[model samples]
Target: MTNSSAKTRAPLSRPIIAGVVTALVGFTSSFAVVLTGLAAVGATPGQAASGLLALSLTMGIACIVLATRYRMPITVAWSTPGAALLAATGLVEGGWPAAVGAFLVVAALILLTALVPQIGALIASIPASIAQAMLAGVLLPLCLAPVTGLALNPWGVAPVAITWLIFARLAPRWAVPFAFVAATVVVIIGVVTSGKTVDPALLIPQLEWTAPTFTLGAVIGIALPLFVVTMASQNVPGIAIMRSYGYEVPWRPAMLVTGLGTAAGAAAGGHAINLAAISAALAAAPEADPDPRRRWVAGLSTGISYVLLGGCAAASAALVLLAPPAVIPAVAGIALFAAFGSSVQQAIDDPGERIPAVVTLLVAASGVAVLGISAAFWAIVAGLLVRGVLHLGRR
Candidate 1:
């Protein structure tokens, strides 16, 4: 490649930097889940760092390769759902090793799903409209949560949320990061002026590493749950996210790489890693780059950012503290405003798929709970299942 072309291709564009920052922006939402997963699995602080390392390295490399190879604006991330599972069930551990055993099982299941054309095809069969609806539904809570947070002390949250909404509504690209900064300043003022309480006199730095141990029960219960979350919450969203941006890639290789990333993270006390849906959209959007070919550089830039962030947990924590809770939802809502609206609009624009898509959107938005599975998985499943049954009945 020529020097000029290489430079142009490098992920240094203003949009790319914004995208990377946005991708990393999500670190606030699920970090507790990751740490809880680590603690539940008996990892020391050092082990968590190592897990972060493994997770970042694997995801970083994979995103670069996948984006470059596919020539698409693709982005990857850890399964927020998997991390949630870790937070909830990570307690059932043989420590970090147990989590790894769970990771292995999850990886295996994903491989099976990938190899089995039926499964992948079935997922693909989901109407783009329905898929979009599901995504929009999943994001609804986050959008509203900030508003609800207003009840708390409105001073910290209310101002931020309201201002963010206003700014974001008017000027999304400029408004999002601005909202985050504004909200953080509010929270800082709250903490300083009001004297909010804190736990642990100092942030804990417990770091240790132990080989993973596998227990059948842990694998079945703990690991399987994490796997499901990774696939449902992380991968499904990832594919939809990529497609949302108009990139086409075979799902199998993507699944494999994500599975491997998760396993590698598990080795370090992290949970399932995979293609990022929400955070990635920030980086991979048409807005991130007017030219899609140059977008891979953005993905690569994100990976490099991960390396830096992953290096120091303390630093990560400090950065996390940089933003107030209100900042997260307000800014995230702002950033996602376009994508969500566009996806929903796209899904409903087609009259043939409108009904099924509407059903999917409603089902996803309902937040109903029958099984332990979160609403995300069920939205897709029920939407497709309903569509299938209707088609057969019509025949």
Candidate 2:
């Protein structure tokens, strides 16, 4: 609190601020997707809260550990695409327990990818453009939530949108974070004026465990697809984000930690945790700190923030529960617009990969479910098939 200490820490404030912004963006943006996914798998509200807490803690630890060990801004996040896949897939034979089992299976598969180099190689072999396309496809519909909010609550969404637009022009780096602040202000005013309050108990940490049940249907319908989507859409892109910023990341240790983290989360109704994509960019970007070597502080700060947020899981969950249905999604969509734009551009960047990438995008965007499998899994399959056929023709 003293001036001298404050002056000393001033130089490091940018990365710290960036890290906090990244944590807020990641947690606020995709948590609804996680809740919806857990609900679809038959988790009760309490179970869902516990799941969110578990995931937050695991991912926070992963980000902190990996970033510190490697001296790189390695971020971790729950697999948003995998969560969407869960939302689309619905409940399996044994309800929540079966879903838990499926989650464990998916975690084990992720671990296998670390232990068995061939599986990781196989995933890496997929054209990066196609993977980007699939991620874009998965994110496209959610990004429209702000538009949906505009129709449903223009008064609430307009100011947020205008703020983002203004900042994006004047201070591009802070656009999303500024918009988030604007929206948070609006929400607080509405809550206070409306005289609506949440129970303090919701702010307390609680843990719940489900006895997992392994069923063939759950494994086939949920596990495989979840693994594929989390690996392709989240883990791969997350690594690419770090590399895009010129960081050399070791894949095996990262995968092992995330795999272990996902499994730890599964015991408490969480789905999957993987490397972060968008938030990783925030921490890894040069803007986080002038000295690139010290940018790991951003990841460390993000991890610490996530842990704090996890402690407030109950209150955070309650806020989402009380908000206007469209509000959460709109805010989340706004936070994700930059990420969506990047994915779309990357998806089509390579002319040779364009067709397959487009195919993947279209399939993922379609949201088609066939025989209990989600479109994301099919998108990858379809894109790879198209790519293989094209390769054969060249041969």
User: Best TM-score goes to which candidate?
Assistant: 2
Worst 10 residues of 2 by lDDT: 316-325
lDDT of 1 by residue, 1-395 (tens): 78976676534475568546755665543443354355545565556555655666667777777776776656677665454334434344355576667777776777777788775565555566766766666555545655666664466566656765676679654455555566657756756776765444224433334566777656755655455445555677677777878776678888877766666655555566777877777777776776676777677777666655555454334333444545444544444455557667866898867777777767756665344344545666777777787677574
Report the lDDT tens digits of candidate 2 across residue range 175-225. Answer: 766776677677777888889887877778787999999987788778876
Which regions of candidate 1 are displaced past 4 Å? 1-57, 64-74, 79-106, 113-116, 166-171, 196-253, 267-272, 276-299, 311-343, 352-363, 371-385
Error of 2 at 101 (Å): 2.4
lDDT scores for all predictions? 0.61, 0.82
Give TM per candidate. Answer: 0.63, 0.83
Model 2 root-mean-square deviation? 4.3
CA displacement after TM-score superposition, residue 13 of candidate 1 (Å): 8.5
Provide the lDDT at 117 for model 2: 93
**TM-score of model 2 relative to the true fold?**
0.83
Q: Against the true structure, candidate 2 has what lDDT?
A: 0.82
